[model samples]
Target: MSTQLSEDEIIQKISGNDLTIGSCASQALTYIGNKCGYDVRDFRGADSRWLFGQYTTSQKIAEAGGFVECDYNGFKIADRLLRNVEEGKEYFYTSGEHAAIIRKTGKKFEYLETQSKHIDENGFHPLTVNVLKKRFRTTKTRKLEGEKFLQKEVLIETSKISDSPNFKELLGYLNTDPKNQKREVPK
Candidate 1:
């Protein structure tokens, strides 16, 4: 069963962990992101899996061996975070007012988890959209070339909004055509 923790409790737990500055956190931390109102569903999507393979050869090798099931067992948020590490994208968290600090690298990134500062901004937020664009272009963008591209390519991140968040919004933005994004097919 899922255990719900208060924001303070969550923060305390995070502080207590030995998490590196930019590496993905244990599942406990992802649960905190959910409780704090951030949407991390994208980390759990097909696109993430594909890009991770592109970025982390180890993960690609793992996928070939059927290790991908570790990501599909629910607790998607945490699974996605670890996958992101394998994919070369770093993981981070921040105070709402500060920049996100990489958990493993100790580098501070420019993205924030909240939208409060982005409302007046005209461009896509780097924290949310840039990495996705990089992922799409590097791994999934060739499909625009022709049907042949689609046939050989790994599936993209496309999923519908069900009763829960599952990375659809992030993928919709990253995909070339927003309307083309599809609900995640059950594995």
Candidate 2:
């Protein structure tokens, strides 16, 4: 049976553990996935490419259909964590070269990460978080060389709708194509 662990419980379980190191992000993701009734082996298998070659943690998660990428201002990381995240969904946060997981529980957030020396008891915070979701395919059109026609590349891009207050505004602006912009007069 799967047991959903509280933030404190997760922290306690990982604190001072030697497994806390470079694989911390993967470990946290595995814990969350297992609790959510996903097969831990599937997650590990998707994350295993690191042993044979180089692939980003986010890339692995995307391949596993575990999370979707969304946009948020890095400056509002703390506010977004408290206001936007939902319970039972796993969030992946990355800053520069480091990555971690942030899980929401009962109106609060719990951060988890692994790194060399020890597990971060102080909690891990990253600039961005990707929430778990089902995967979907997206198509992008590109110009083909030596031909007047354009070609479409069907890519399995990770995508999500943002929950931020400004999300709608951003979406509206993004939906307006460049041709539409030129047709509209400035106020």
Q: Which candidate comes out best when scored by TM-score? A: 2
Taken over the whole model, the C-alpha lDDT of each candidate is: 0.28, 0.35
Q: Considering only N, C-alpha and C atoms within 3 Å, which residue pairs clash in candidate 2?
A: 21-115, 21-116, 24-114
What does candidate 2's lDDT look like per residue over 54-139, in tens digits?
A: 23435544343333333232223334334545666656544323345665676655555432233433344432234211111111
RMSD of each: 18.2, 18.8
Q: Estimate each model's TM-score.
A: 0.20, 0.37
Misplaced by over 4 Å in model 2 are 2-4, 17-21, 37-53, 64-89, 103-111, 114-120, 124-187
lDDT of 2: 0.35
84-146, model 1: which lDDT tens digit per residue?
Answer: 332223233211112122222233223322211222331123443344333222232233445
